[model samples]
Target: MKIIVDAMGGDKAPEEVVKGALNASNNPEIEIILVGDEKKIRPYLKDSDKNIEIVNAQEVITYDEQPVNAIRKKKDSSIVKGLKMLKDKKAQAMVSAGSTGALMAGGLLILGRLEGIDRPAIATLCPTAKGPILMLDIGANSEVKPKNLVQFAVMGSIYSKEILNKYNPTVGLLNIGTEEEKGNSVVKTAYSELKQISSVNFKGNIEARNIFDGDFDVVVCDGFTGNIFLKTVEGFGMYIFHQLKNEIKKSPRYLAGAALLKPAIEKIRSSMDYSEYGGAMFLGIDGVLVKCHGSSDSKAIENGINVAYNSVISSINEKLREGLKSVTEKGE
Candidate 1:
């Protein structure tokens, strides 16, 4: 399988991206296509294996640039070229640590949405006590209708079973309260529709407080709420860890104790670290797209490449199409 990597997207850009892609190239079955300025990408690739391929892309889309405008104007940007490779079937999947808006824009405009899909939703895997739970529309479409929510649940379920290896994953609507009538009209309507779909294992509602408890496998929410929820969780996790380290360092007594507890602390940090999981999967799109964090390191890029490779081999899009069609037929 051939996977395209955007070597010019994230904060670290070509350096980390090249290192990660080269590391991932160790897999004999997978080939890496690094898309960026050839001059910068080639130097770092001296130690890379023969599995790596470089594609030259001169322009780059920055975070501050308007997403739609950047995509339209920057035809030779790494993001656009990598996405085009996937669209043209030259590559099976695409991974990027660039601007989320530009990636989403390119996915919709270049690759297009799946035939039955109304809109593509961003599905991010969050580490939880039970395991990683899949949440959708993390930053895709902020405003959506009842139908969109129902579709998100459908796509989320397929993703959990196929990619996460969860069988019959329970789906829940993220809401203010667990009651059926608690949310706005859109969510209330989505709840009723979700319950009717036999393919979806719809569990009425999931409150923000209980999400970490591992009660639900798939959580569905509007992009606006889900983005805020995801960011808050990430920020709070970082804050708590930082504060703990600072407090432990203040006293020599606590510092010595922390050394003894180092193993346990490392385990907790690993569980909460987003880097381990690589990137978020953009579901409902025609091709496989993994959006890594803007500050992703080499390890994260390697993980992202693995996800893209596996998703392609697993025929994830086929399963998604079948799952969506099954739900639509039964619901109709």
Candidate 2:
């Protein structure tokens, strides 16, 4: 499998991205294509690395630029070039730790949406107490119709089952309350539609507070709500760790206790780390696209490449097309 890495897309560009791509290239089955300024990306590569290739992309799309405009104008940007490679079937998938907007826009404009999907959704895996839960529309579409939510559910369910190895994954709609009567008009309508879909194992509404329990394998929500929920969880995790460190330093007794429980603490920390989950998958798109966090480090980028590799080997887009077609046929 061939995978493209946007070497200049993230904050740590070239260096970290190159390192991660090299690490993933160790797998003989995969070929790594690093897209960015060749001059900046070459220093990190070893002469012995034969599986890795570099494609020169002179421009970069910054977060400041409008997504669609940047994609159109910056033809030589790493984001655009990598996406174009995927569209041309030169690579099986592309991974980027760049501006989320540009990646989404590039995916839409270059690869286009799958036939039955209205709008592609971003499916992010969040660590939970029981295990990991998949949530969709984290930042793809802030506003969505009821039909859009139904599509999100369908895609999320297939991803959970195929990639995550979940058996008959149960999906839940993120809402303010657990009752079907709750939420705004869009959600209420979505709830009714989701229940009628026989393809997805649709559970009733799930509140954000109960998400970490891992009762549901997949959670569907509009981008506006899903983004807030993801960010809040990240902030709360940071706050807890920070407060714990401060408290441990203040008291000798606490310090001793913390030292004794260091192993357990590290385990908890690893579970919550975003790098462990790799990156979010842009589902419903015509091709495989994985978007890493803007500030992702080498380890995160490496894992993101693995995620893309898995998606490609699984032939996930083919499955998604078939799944959506089946749903549409039944509805019609």
User: By TM-score, who's the top model here?
Assistant: 2
- lDDT of each residue in 1-332, candidate 2, tens digit only: 99999999789997988888888888898899999999999999889988999999999999889999999999999999999999999999999999999999999999999999999999999888879989999999999999999999999999999999999999999999999999999999999999999999999899999999999999999999999999998999999999999999998999999999999999999899898899899998899999998888899999999999999889999999999999999972
Write the residue-wise lDDT of candidate 1 on 156-208 in tens digits: 99989988899999999999999999989999999998888888899899998
* Poorest stretch of ten by lDDT in candidate 2: 323-332
lDDT of each: 0.91, 0.94
Model 2: lDDT equals: 0.94
TM-score of 2: 0.98
How many Å off is the CA of 127 in candidate 1?
A: 1.2
Q: How well does candidate 2 match the true structure, expressed as C-alpha RMSD?
A: 0.9
- The total of clashing pairs for model 2 equals 0
lDDT of 2 at 46: 82
Colliding residue pairs in candidate 1: none
